[model samples]
Every structure is written in structure tokens, then in C-alpha cells.
Target: MDLELRHLKVVTAIAEAGSLTRAAIGLGLAQPALSAQLKRMERALGGELFVRGPRGVRPTELGELVLERARVLVPAVAELQEEARRFGRKRAAGQGQPARYRLGGTHGPLLGGLVDRLASACPGASVTTYTSWSTRELAGLLAEGRIDFVLTGVCGRSRPPSGGGGAALVWREVAVDPVFVMLPEGHVCAAREEVPLAELADACWTNVPGDGCFAQCFAAACARAGFTPEAVYETDTASCVHLVQVGRAVGLCRATFPPTPGLVTRALRGSPLMWRHVLGWHPDSPAARTAEAILAHTRAVHTRAAELSPSYARWRRGHRAAL
Candidate 1:
């Protein structure tokens, strides 16, 4: 069967918008033209592509399957166009430009440090950083060639994509940040050189709302300790340090918290206790090299940060002293 680019575009637009009229508006095409394109493509394939309803157009089982395949194929074609445009510019200039790398993560010190290391390592490379979003959204950006790599605190909820999602990206575990409970100097918890999860499970917590990454593990640890957190406030911003400083509430932060006034962080007691933040990328992207570079840089930064941080040094000294 023969097909055209318009056919794929129409299908993808409709799938994304879930309505032909909205799809037409999004694609800047007349509704009739868009409908005709879909109909012709369905006829050529000898089947109906979508079912129309009062609400909107819903993809049939076949349409849903075709749309999934088109999701991968369509973006790939667009990326090829973008790459070709860049390549043509390079050819015109007699010098290929350095590769661009896009990276983002949840708003936190760890991600901030990761971005710093990437910029330092890939000097002259294009870089973009974003904060506050889900990993799945990052995965979508990767598939579309909008971002090269993503480094975020691992939620431990990601399954290896199998059918549709699996085709789009791959995840690699880079480092697991030991869970450190941050407290103000002379706070009750600070009396202990090292605290146990069970010991602090009932502690009043300062949490970011809708944060499945750290929140999930925090909740699980509380459950394991037979108590839940007494969350006094919900926030999704980068104010954990400030909140802890004022003694508003205790919080858990990664190992990379830079020196701040009145803040002390210590690891929770347990073998292999920590939050694992992973790097993500589209496995088939042309920017995979750039992604790999960013990941390598991030790992080095994590190691170096842990080595240099006074909090980590104190932990090591305490552990050795106990031994």
C-alpha cells in the first residue's frame, strides 16, 4: 500500500488532539482537507482509521496501534529535517557546528550540579536546563529530539518500556544518592551523629507536592517504621534548605546540598539506603553521543561532590570512628 507524509501527519495530529477539528487547527490545515487525507489513507489501507463520536474522534484499536507506530516514525522524520538543516548550515560555513545537548531535571541541588558539570565538560556546546516536570515528559522530549539527556532523582517506579514506550527511550542508573536528613544545628535530630529511618519516621516533614520521586521512598520508609509523616506544609520549589534553616520542618535532600547556614545533613541508617537518580535518553537519537557525555560528566560530578562535601566527610569519619 502506498502512503504519504500528509497521511502520517494527519494521523499524528488527530492522535495528539483526539479531535479532527482541533487537529486541523493545530496543523494549520482546513478541516475538510484533513478529514479527506485521513479517509484516503484509511481507504488505501482497506480499513477505518478512527471512529467519530459526539465528544471527538477516537482511534480504533487499529488506529491506536497505527498511531503508536506513527508517533515514533513522525518525530523521527521531523528530527531528520532539523538535523539536515543544521548539516546544510555547517556545509555552507565549511565547519560542522558542535553538537547541542539538552538536559533537565527536578529542581534541586543535585540536578543543578549535574548541569554545571555538563557545561564545564562540553565547552562551546549548546545547553538548556529545565526544572520541575515528570520523567515521562522528559522521555517525550527525548523522543522528539528536543533534549539530549535527562538526569532526575529516580522514582523507582519506571519499568523498562515494553511495547510502545520501550521503543522510545532507554534508562541507565548512574548513581544512588544516600538519603540525608537535613536539620538545623542543635535540633533534636542533630544530637545523633547518624539517625535511623525508624527513628525519624514520625518527624514533621517538609515535602514537595506531587513529588513521586522522593516522596514515594519517604512514605515507604515511614510505613516500614510503622508511622507516617506529619507534613506541615507542601511545596514544590527549591526552598528545602531555607525551610530547614528556619526550623519550619525537617527534610530529606540528596548528597549535593552546598554549604548553607544552619543546615546539617546525615544519612539514614540502613544497608544500601539512598535515592537512585538515573539518566534517561532516546536510545536511537543522533544526540546519543552528547547524552553519553552528559551522563559521564554527571557521574563524575556526583563522585566529586560527595568527596568534597563536609557532610559526607563527616559521615565517613563517623563511620570509621564507629568501626
Candidate 2:
């Protein structure tokens, strides 16, 4: 309960986002969980940090004092950590140690491919991975030099993480993939090769939660189609697959989502949504030295995935949106 660096981050995130729910999304926590954590934080500090209102929360006098100090400490600690990492890298090279690769990202196909490629290219090297749903969390880790690289995706035209260590990183596009809808093979929509967004207006939906703008983008697209989704169940990828397999809901999937039994993925009409796969790393880090080769490996994985998905391969032949 002692005020820690993580607590400072929570306070800062809520203040910047202006609402508990938005802050929770950005922090990769459920609103209820974030609220509970705030209560604990308040109890430990002996005061409430925010005054909640219908519009959003605002800082009290005490909250302002805490925030002012937190802003200074957070970035200063980040810089110190980066300096330490740089020194460590130099020492490792001086000792003739094997190369080390530390990667972070949410669940996806590209991460695995990149790992395999790096291992093959650098024999006897050390490659490790860390996975999380929060974009800010990953960015924070990268900025602190805890990880060497990140592989993630964004919605059509939406940008990558802009705050929480994201600003210090350089991002490069790995590939652009069309978003696909996954449904039970026997479902009525499965009859069509390309289903309209409006066609599933009444259907319940399920998706894996992540700290990306994808959920918001999906809502916006649904609005354009003249209907709101009846319900959106946020859970893990396996659960999403199970929900779709049981005919309980449709799923938003990447076009490269490998085929599963009883599930068939199809394109949406007009290509209303797309996923932009991107890779990021600190420009000053060792990862930068091999960024070119890493990027090529990732691009090759995307191309291979497309070839494996027959439906995607056939549809892509007639459209260039995914490229």
C-alpha cells in the first residue's frame, strides 16, 4: 500500500484520460478493477485523489500535489533505466557474451515468427518474450529498456500508442491486413463470401480486449452501418473462439487468423475495416542494429499467412486493400 511508482502511473493516467473507464482501457484494466485499485491507493495515501463526476473526474488539492511530483519522477526514472541498459549492453559486448533479444507484444502470429527467425539467424543467441494486452504497458517496458522490440497492430488510419513511453519509440509498418469476421461454419452469414457489416447488427459479438483503438473503431464502423452491436463480450482469444464455435456470437479476426474447426472467417463488404501491423523499438537500443533484417522476417511471415488462408488468398486476388 506504500505509494509506489505504479500507483503514480495510475494517478497520471486517470488525470490525463479524464475518466476512470478510459484510463482503465489505456491501462489494460477493467473499470471495476481500476476503481478498486484507486480506492486502495486512496486508503494508503490517506486521501481521495480524484473527485468523480458525470462528465469525468477532477483532481482535489491533495491530488494536484501528488500529480505534480509524479510527473517529474516518472520520466526521470525512465531515463535512468535507459542509461543503465545502455551501459549493460556495452559491458555485455566487452565480455563476449551471446546476443540478447527481449521482445514484447500482445498475442499475434508475427511475434512467434520473429522469434524463430531471430534464433535461426543468430545461433546461440538469447531471445525472450513478454506479452500483454496494454499498448502503453508494452511501450512503457520498451522505454525503460526492459524489452528490445514490440510487435503490435492498429486499426485503419489509427496511430500507435502516443503516450506512456510511446513517444520515445520509432514504429515501422510490418504489413496491412484486412479485418475479417469469424462465424460458425453453419451460420447463415457463412453462405456469403463477403458479409455486410449491417448483416450482423443483431448478433452478439466477442473480441479479445487490448489497449488499442480497435474496439472504438469497431463501434464507429457499426455506427456507419446504421446499428449498434447488441453486446460485446471481451475475453481471451480462446474464449472468443469458443463463443463463435458455439454459435453464441460473431468475432472480429485478422484476415490471417488460421482456420479452426467449425469456424469460417469472411471478408466484410467494402473492406470497412483493416488492421495495420506495426513494429517498434527504441532507436538508441541494440535492436536498432538489426531492425532491417527483423522487418524483412516479419513481412515474410505476413505473406506466408495470406497464402495459407485460401479464402483470403482468393479474395485478395481481386482486391489490393490488404496490401
Candidate 3:
């Protein structure tokens, strides 16, 4: 089509101003040029766009419909143009990958493995991993296209969209690692098959900032165990594994724990507690291929973690006597 945005701009201005003279003045175009552009557009669209009256030019019904579409089309085209320019600049830089990816999660044994696995698998792809304290920050990045994918716990149950007009991002469950109580080798609770909540009823538990979902779950579990927790020290970072390894605190729970060089995991007997991990990416993203590759890598790690649990069970036997 010989159609151009200049035609739409002229028509829209005329419809809004309700006069060709005012529209032409606003657009800095001669009255005849603006009128000619409108005629060209009407001819191309196979309909009359304007009706001239004694007072002014008014949009026809067809013109109203075209104007409505132009409202959306104009900004969408502008954004596409900006994106194309960015892509050109990135290409010129000779960036390592065809697409950029941002992935984030709080540090943990599971996430550590995931980062290594993803980077190794997509060696040519650029992957940025952020250890953030805010879920909203992560969500905002996804919405703004600052990040391609995010791996974290669903902070809590949230309400769905009211109108459901927009596309929902894709989310997949990654792992459900139980919140384990981490303690040093000879703690009394570690000797038991499962650490009883009552056993630590009065124990001073070290608390980390509840910025991530796992930390929130940990706080709730402690409350269910019937105690407002007392923290020996509070750090914005979840360095509980460090505190546990040195026996600074009696115990701490996390979604993923590094295999303590000397520390051990005491499963609390009952409903085996765990935090849900989710992988997410925008459905409309251009990074779909990168997101798919990252998701596949994470799933494989989760599967391998499942297969390796037998080793954990075997290791638990040696720690049983201490419990």
C-alpha cells in the first residue's frame, strides 16, 4: 500500500480539531497538502474519510474506525522502530549471542548448579544472574523487558487478572526442595530421624531477611512450630549455611542448602516441608528460544537432583547416631 503515517497523522489531527484549517496549521502543512493527503488515504482505504460542512470538516463513520486503529498502530510502529535500531546496534557490537538473557534467584545449592548448567550449555549466549532480595523487582524487570527469564519461588498466592485481556507469562514448576534445618555435626536434633519442632521450641534460631519466598516459608514454619523466632544476628543476605556450619545458631531452614562440608540436613518428620520453585518468562518475548534453552537446562538439573537423593539417604545414616 502507498499508505503512510503522514496520512494518518493528518486525518487524526483533523478529526480531533474538527477543522481542516486548524489541523493543517497544527501539522505545519498547507491546507491543500493536508486535504490532498486525506484524499489519498481515503482513496487507498476505499472509503470516504471526511465530510465537509458549512462550519468544519468532520470524520465519517469509516474515518472514526480508522482513527481508532491508528491510535494503537502509531505507538506500536514507533516501538518497533526503536527496537530495530537497538538490534542493529547490538549486532554491530558483535555481542556473543543472538539474544540476551537475564536470570535471577537467591543463592543456594540448587541455583548454583542451575547457573553453571545454563552457562555451560549456552556457552555462546550471554546470561546475567542476579541475586535479588525483591520479588517485585524481578517482576518489574520482566515486565519492562529488562530480563528474559526469572527463577524464584512464587512469593504467595496472588489474584489473577480481572479482565484477562493481556497474555500471561509462562511459568513452570522447577523443584520442590524441602526446607531443611541446617545445623553443625553434633547438634542434639541432628541425632534424630527428624528434628522435632518441640525440640527447638526454645532454641535461638538465626533469622535472615524474608525477602525471598523461601525465607517467608521459613518464618511461617517457625510460627506454626509455635514461637516468635529469636535471631542471633540478621543479615540481608541468606548466609545461614555459614552460620550453621560454624554452629553459631542451632538451626536454619532454606529451600536449597549447600552440602555443608561438615554440616548435615535433619529432615523434620511429618509432612515433608518444601518450597516451590518457578521458572518464568514473558509470553510475548523475542527471547523465546533462549528462555526455552534455559528452562530445559533447569529441568535437567532438577531431574538429576531427584536421581541423586539416594546418595543423600545413604549419607543420612551416618548422621543418624548424632541425631
Candidate 4:
């Protein structure tokens, strides 16, 4: 029997969880079923993938090599399956069904406005939004055709890498989003309208876990300002906001985010950190036409958002010609 994506998944899961029992639970299979599958996979490959131990299990040298390749293969296969399912659903819905646009991105004011505008512009069409903290992840989905387009942040100082699948994708910048320091309402620096990057050298920071474009931009900016931020906590948007609100740590946010009750956002002095919201899509996909229509509305939505954000507005004024 030939090994398949599922077999590769089993191999990687076993390697990662370090135990067949745990891997079975993660893969939602009974231990015996997983064990049987693993035996078949090992037989097909002519090797033992795991060295069973009293404690758990560890990958053999061959297993480690297989797991490395499986890591990349499994996700690509999964994405292919997901895209097929999505397309099948749309097709089964009939020819009269409205055109569907799947947009994915990080949560931000621009994304919110863009979704609203797209929905308004194409009243009969189905507009779906997917949220991911990582721009590169969103870009990958776009390139895989699982998502029609991506609205994501790209650092001014560092270009966000196109995912492995995004080689043929096109990126269009929609708006500039300046970074802001978010602190507890009563924090010592909260009262200040602008905070210098050096002042927060000793502060604990919260950030999403990823070496994505935004993280690199933040690190580069800190390095230029003569201090590397101590990122003590890694969490998602809601948790990151909560960390700042409860005075546990400071966090960075875009200028366009609406103010939270317990938090105040102060502009970063010297404008060391800034990013642009970009729309990315594969040029050959049907969604490319949808993207053209969306881009027009996106520019208008960003313009309105910039008007509401003083820092973004100031930056926009100077960069008006380029924009």
C-alpha cells in the first residue's frame, strides 16, 4: 500500500506528541487503530518510525527525516482539501448563487471597514471574512485559493514575505497604519500624547507569537531606538489587549483601533514603526476581478479611517502624493 497524506500526518503527529496514545487523541482515533495504521505505514516505508519507550516514544533518524517533509506536505494537502470543499459547496449551491469572496486577515480597523464596504458594494454577493494573526498565513491561504484575497499589514522597513504559494500573487497597498503604544489607562506614560521608544526600554511587552513581518518591524524599530523590547507574553488580540488593560504589560497596536476603556494609545515618537494594509490575490483566479472592485472601495474606507485617526491623518497628509 502506498503512503498518503493521512499517513504522513500520523507520522508527524506521533513525532510531535511523543506518544501514540496522545497522537491518537489529537488525531481523534482509537489507540489500536492508530497503532495499526502506524504499523502499516512503517511496513510500507520499510522502517520503524518510532522507538517505543517506557515513557513515551521518540522518532528514529528515518522518522525525523520523514516528519520534516511531512510537516510541509500535510498542510499543503489540507489546504487543497479545504479549497476543494469550499468550491464544491459553492458549485452545489447552483449557478444562480452569488459570487463568493473569502477575505482573510488580522483584526484591525481597516479590515472591519473594508468588510463593511465590500458588503455594501456587492449587496447580492456573499462576503466572508477570516481572521488570522499572521499576515504570512493569510497570504498563504490567498495563494492556495482557499481564501480569495487577503488584507494584511506589511512593515514599511521590512517587506512581508510572500508565502511559498504566493509567487504569482499581486500585492496592492491600500493604506498606511502607524504603530501606537497601548498602555493601561492609569500607567505613568498613559497621560503623555506621545511616548519615546527609549522610555519603554524596561517595560514588559505583549505580542503575538510569530516571526512575521510585523514582529520583524517592531524588533528593527526597537533596535534603532537603542533597546530591544522584552516581550514577556505571547497572546492573541483579545488577550494582548487584556494584558495592557490590566496593567500587566504594554502592547503595540495600530493607530486606527478604537480606544478601549482601560487602555490609552500613545503615538510612538520618531515614527520608527509603521505598516501598510495591503490587498493580495492571485492574478489568474476569478477572485482577481472581485479584487478590482474591492480595491476601489478599500481605498475609500481607508481614507475615512485615516480621517478618524489623528496620527494616521498626519502621516497621510505628508504621504498624500505617494498614496
Order of all candidates by TM-score, from best down to worst?
2, 4, 1, 3
The top-ranked prediction according to lDDT is 2
Worst 10 residues of 2 by lDDT: 159-168
Candidate 3, 75-179: lDDT as tens digits:
686576448546744663565446456776654455667877867876776767777655544554554455667776643342211111132667777755555
What's the distance in Å from true for residue 76, model 4? 10
Q: Name the regions of candidate 4 deviating beyond 4 angstroms.
A: 1-98, 310-323
| Candidate 1 lDDT tens digits, 1-323 | 48854467668779889899999766544587578778888989778889999999888888987888887887787778468646644563565435576675766666777767667766776778865545544555565556667777654444422112234576777765566778888687787767776776556777554324345566776788778887745665457667888887787766666666788887677622466777777655556645666677778877777777787767766666432
Report RMSD (Å) for each prediction in the order shown.
10.7, 4.0, 17.3, 9.3
Show where candidate 2 strays beyond 4 Å.
Answer: 1-6, 12-47, 52-76, 92-98, 163-167
Q: Of the candidates numbered 1 and 3, which has the greater TM-score value? A: 1
Clash count in backbone of candidate 3: 4
2 or 3, greater by lDDT: 2
In order of appearance, the predictions have TM-scores of: 0.64, 0.83, 0.59, 0.68
What is the lDDT for 282 in model 2?
79
How many pairs in model 4 have backbone atoms within 3 A of each other, for residues 3 or more apart or on separate chains, i.e. clashes?
Answer: 0
Candidate 4 C-alpha lDDT tens digits along 227-285: 98776587888998999998889998777767577888777886678777788887656
- Per-candidate total of colliding backbone pairs: 0, 0, 4, 0
299, model 2: CA deviation in Å?
A: 0.9
